[model samples]
Target: MKANIQYAILIAWGILSVSCKKDNYKAPSGAFSGRLVYQGQPVNVSYNDVYFELWEPGWGKSTPIVVNVSQDGSFSALLFDASYKLVIPAAQGPFRSLTDKTTNSDTILLQLSGNLTRDIEVLPYYMIRQTKFTATGRKVTATFAAEQIIKDAAAKDIERVSLYICKTQFVDGRNSVATKDMSGAAITDPAGISLQVDVPALVPEQKTVFARVGLKIAGVEDMIYSPVQEVAL
Candidate 1:
């Protein structure tokens, strides 16, 4: 009886060991990188202006994967090799969401496996054009033409223009250490615009200061900005 019991136990242990052998599974590895464009022009997507998201199926109520968009209207992120629902949330950028248009759906099916370079087109409320910046002793000047994406002069949408200055390269409305502005009045002709900022004498000398000009359209809630540039102060 003891010999028979030992034989059965050994057979059962062998079966269990084989069943528990791990399966060789390889995870999908891929990357996505792209720019945000509007009317064939790349947008200067500032911080917190937009997001890149992926919604994997079978993950009900799961948090969406997100990636940050840099100041130059470009973004990149890693993703698994699978079919996922890709979406860009509305009203996150300087422009209105392209999702509002019937032909341009904000969401799409993406099959990620390898590196990707794509552009997400948007309909901006406005765009800055022909921007030039020059830094003189303790002062910086910016000149630019503002082009409204929704150009109805009668709407009187442009609220103001401002010059942002920062000690580092991350220059924006919220990140600027100092600012100069034209606000509280309607901009009748955004096409013709100029602004300047005088760096504070209290600031210690640095190798480079970053600067940019930003334009605001009332009710847009976000300012469309010019390209940030390094200037010698």
Candidate 2:
């Protein structure tokens, strides 16, 4: 009886594989690709990801599609050629809540077709304009300015400005050796908000170190960034 069952399972598996090979299907031709921009400039999006929910009929609580945002804030996804009602999750971004439908525009839709490009403009809570690193003796100083473009609520902008030090050029909160965060106060500086980091503790004198200063919003999952700077300490 066991031998018979094994033979039957092998036949079923072979038939299933043959059927799948015969029914070759290609994904939809329609796709959505665009960059995240603020103040007419492309930006590295927070959280390094974007989540889009499908709100079509008979789609009862389906899992949302997740797209990885590139280093310079670009993203693309394969989608069917249809009008998709999209929903942005709460506390997923540094921008203000997409909720409050009565007071704000919460209905975001995508009329996407073949090779569609639609950019999403978000008012960043804080924009890191420039970052420069200089080493003096054993201490390396990171100088940068963050401009507060959008007046975020205290809770949203709760975390203070921070400077991250790492060995890799592509540095963020995730892959960092050390971080100096001004944790007590909310970063509300509309002008130049600077933070200094001691790079010698984490990096050697002959090695190349990378520094980036940014702000992590209290509720958001992604850390907003500044350009990375390389310094030999």
Candidate 3:
């Protein structure tokens, strides 16, 4: 009788241990949320399809989170606990595909644990302008102006905008010229409204010049280049 009682007590102990282990283990099944913005405005208003992806260190499978932006540019989505990379494709039209080009895509990294809400903003990559130079016997003056969007006003200051005259070549309507940093040669005014590049001795001729304008922001990539502007020199 004594031996039988001891055996029963050992069995109960083993079962309790297994039950406690099972109760303590939990699986990942929570969600995360976030907002996407460009410059200062929301992105969903302009982009119809946005791609969101999440990756984990040892997880075998990758999870994809998709969201549709509303007219006001707000968005919400559910995600798991992992590292994520997000991208929004360019819309349709002349300006639609500007951000879709291989060089213009925006990428953001996020780490989600349990549930979270994050805000992200993307800035424009380049500024483009059209300029013309008129020469009257040794005097040359040029006027340049372009439209730009400030994705992140806090990240960029409009007062320090600079324009660069890039020597470029085009292939199939795409800039083929190897772009360089020419901001030192560009011009900026006190008001930061527009840039006027003056070529004192440049002769009267039709030449193509590329302009890039941007600002330097902390914790962000180099000043975003404006879309390549084609100017006649």
Candidate 4:
């Protein structure tokens, strides 16, 4: 009975040693970073709403590693050095996906080594331009221009244009202290559009606010936005 117990203890030690070896594998050391851009400009979207995927194809039953794009349209991931197929899934943003000439597909092949920074270019339906913000007493006004980028058969009408103001830099549809919207039909001159909304009393009573203009495309899930601007009250 004593000899049988000694053999069982040896077997248990071997199993634990193998488990520790598997857990000691090195972590990913490569850094991959990029931004979504349109015509050399960042295509800002709603926070945590837009994301892309990286698929490493060598292993069988491959699963996509999801990377979330920030509000400023940037993404970063630490990965093991390998070739990955980058894909922005269909119907993700308020823009059309670019085609990869080599594959004639939506997937763009990327080879990452150490640190890589590449911009993923997309075609937006409309871009908010020339945004200016000002505060007069309790009211804040935002003026901006909208330029339609897609004029072909794929062009989409604007659902609405909105001005958003918040105490922080995260000024969007869902997160704002004040917001105002303008209908698409009311926009006769796309070159010049303006909106005004009254700022409310803050809990801590601050004098600075961040603002931005967002243009929602008809039938699109996401809205294209301008860079955040600071307004002084």
Candidate 5:
């Protein structure tokens, strides 16, 4: 009778220990995934070692989540149940064009539930300046200006304005050049209009030189034109 009792107690202890171990273990939650594409092409973007943030509407707060974007433009993240306004820092990533002032907004929206994958597309509007090029005695110069009429929605001219220029080139039927700070290289008029330019010495042979003039405003695309004027040496 004593031996039987001891055997029963040992069996009970083993069962309890196994039950406790099973109860304490937990499984990982689901993950979210997506790809970033532009014009039907995958973009190789760099991320700044930071996780993207998702903001809840009207909550005035956000949550940080880890994100991994592969070289092929695919991305993955772990998230919980929530509707989020996603935002990545403009300083990093292949979505540099998304940071262009012409773009309406840099933030994207996402809904996460369980393990899922999605594809995201982002288009960027580039602000370009209008230009007219002229050549004289082996000296080539391009002049750029804006054509958009500056007026408020009430059709009244605004007193103050900011304008800038960008050097542009067409690449494989797409605008590939990035807009740079041309403030020092620009010629500003008294009314605060700006122009694009190219020095004579820098002009290459038979190359189509273009300039883009951009107006400063949120959601405003660049106005671009090229009027080539040639002169004989």
Candidate 6:
């Protein structure tokens, strides 16, 4: 009986060891990088607000790998070398998601072997252009043109334009020290728009601040934003 129990214990240990080894696979070795582009120009968006999904099929796994786009509209991910179905969920950004016809869905199929770089095109409702930021005394002013890019059945009216200023480079509606808004009704000319926000006293006292202009569509949750600009206080 003692020999039999020892033999059983050894078999169980061997089983557990093999299971652990199978589960402990190597990390992903391939990389996927790209940008969200419109006419070959990168679309600037709020950091971490926009993302895409990558689903690796044939693994009996339905969960997706979420990759967030950077402020400059670029994204990078380390993935296993396999076939992936990439898709951007509907109404997830300031722009419209492109649908893939072959899959009859919004997914774009990718066969990544080592490293791949491809820019995904999108149609934005509006593009903030010619942004200029100036700081005078305790106020920071922003001047930009809100160009309507979509003018069809999918076109949306402007909801509001905002000027956001932050002590750091991450300037947005949520991470700003000062902000100013302009209603859509007040905007007479889309080509020329101006907004000003009073800067608050920084706790650490800094001479420079980062700023950007954001354009919100009437029914859109994500606002199209301009590139970050540095201004001296």
RMSD of each: 5.2, 5.1, 15.6, 1.4, 13.0, 1.7
How many clashes show up per model? 0, 1, 10, 0, 9, 0
TM-score of each model, in listed order? 0.79, 0.70, 0.32, 0.95, 0.35, 0.93
lDDT of 4: 0.91
lDDT of 5: 0.43
**How do the residues 117-178 of candidate 2 rate in per-residue lDDT, one tens digit apiece?**
87766667767776667777646676666666766444355466677777877777778776
Runs of candidate 5 exceeding 4 Å displacement = 1-28, 46-51, 55-63, 97-104, 123-233
Judging by TM-score, tell me the better candidate of 1 and 6: 6
**Candidates ranked, most accurate by TM-score first:** 4, 6, 1, 2, 5, 3
Clashing pairs in model 6, backbone N/Cα/C closer than 3 A: none
Per-residue lDDT of candidate 3, residues 196-226 (tens digit): 4443322344355544443332333223233
Models sorted by lDDT, best on top:
4, 6, 1, 2, 3, 5
Which lDDT value does model 3 have at 69? 47
Q: How far is 210's C-alpha from truth in model 2 (Å)?
A: 2.8
Instruction: Give candidate 5's TM-score.
Output: 0.35
lDDT of 5 by residue, 142-182 (tens): 44443333343523221222222222332111332323334
- Poorest stretch of ten by lDDT in candidate 6: 97-106
Local lDDT at 75 for model 6: 98
lDDT values of the candidates?
0.76, 0.66, 0.44, 0.91, 0.43, 0.90
Residue 140, candidate 3: C-alpha displacement in angstroms: 47
Better of 1 and 4 by lDDT: 4
The lDDT, on a scale of 0 to 1, for candidate 3 is: 0.44
Clashes of 1: 0
